[model samples]
Target: METSATVAFVVYALLFGWRLVDAVEGSASVAVLAGGIVAGYLVADLVSGLAHWVGDRFFDETTPLVGQNFIAPFRRHHVAPREMVEHGLVELVGNTAILALPPMALAHHSLRPDSLPLLFSGGLLLSSLAGAVCTNLIHRWAHMPRPPGPARWLQGRGLILSPERHARHHRRPFDRAYCITTGWLNAPMDRLGVWKAVERWLGRAARQDPR
Candidate 1:
């Protein structure tokens, strides 16, 4: 399943790239395409943060559907951060690739050769999915003692997640710097106490639940 998903993801990504180029050559606005790509990255970063926050806060590793697969690895990462570094590429990206497929397929199908709006929106969605696919690998690199040179360069420039930025999340309370994609939203989100606020709201709602 993982291998299949990974192959599908690569194929879809290549297809999207080919279609995007054709759209551009067909007179789609370069400015709109650029804006979509930028927005996609930002949205992907925000999503990574939210998923990190939720996985860290709410569910345990035994919670049925997401238990062993999602929640367990997330919980274990805090105890054994380097374990992620040891994961195979397919192990690291397979689940995210599976998660990203439906939307990616929809966007691919919706993309029209002559429609600039479809091109822009499809570009945004596809780029966001691409970022999602890369998120785990990027996170793994941040935990590595000596990541590849390209990753190191990107980390230094703050273009992707960095060990220095991610370290704070590993500190006691394990609460800040949840944005592990580019780590761009971490500071502002932490300063605003967004996760804390959400936790508090969930706490209140849970207490009032009849279940």
Candidate 2:
């Protein structure tokens, strides 16, 4: 499954790249593409935070569907934060690659010549998936004793999640700094009490549930 997902991810990524280049050459403005890339990064960060929050706060490792594969990893990471560093590339990115396939496929098929809007949207979707595909690797880097020089540089500049920023999430309560993609949204989201509010709502909903 991992190997297949990785191969599919590579194929879709290449297709998206080709379409993106074609769009640029045809009619898409550089500014629009740049905006889409920026928007994609922010959206990916937001998504990472929401998924991280859900993984950390809800469902046990024994629950159905997401239990063993998803929830367990998040739970284990809290106990053994450095374990992610030992994961291979396929292990790190395969699941996200699987999740990314549909949108990537759609973007590849939907992108057209001289259509700035489609180009912009395609750029946003593909870039966001690209960010998503890199999330686990980025998270692993944060836990590494010393990541690659380029990663270290990005982390230092706050262009990506850093060890220092991610450390707060592993601390007791484990309720803050959930945006593991770039850490750009962590501060604002934490300050706004977004996760806390969601937790409160979920708690109330659970209490009211008949199940």
Specify the highest-TM-score model's number.
1
Off by over 4 Å in 2: 25-28, 204-211
lDDT of 1 by residue, 83-142 (tens): 999999999999999989877777667666466776678678877899889999999999
Q: Give the TM-score of candidate 1.
A: 0.91
| Residue 51 lDDT (model 2) | 85
Whole-model lDDT per candidate: 0.83, 0.82
**lDDT tens per residue, model 2, 1-211:** 9779878888988888777776675333777877788899889999999888778777778879988988889878887888989999999998999888878877677666366776677778877898898899999999999899999999999888999999888786667898999989999989999888877877753221111
TM-score of each: 0.91, 0.90
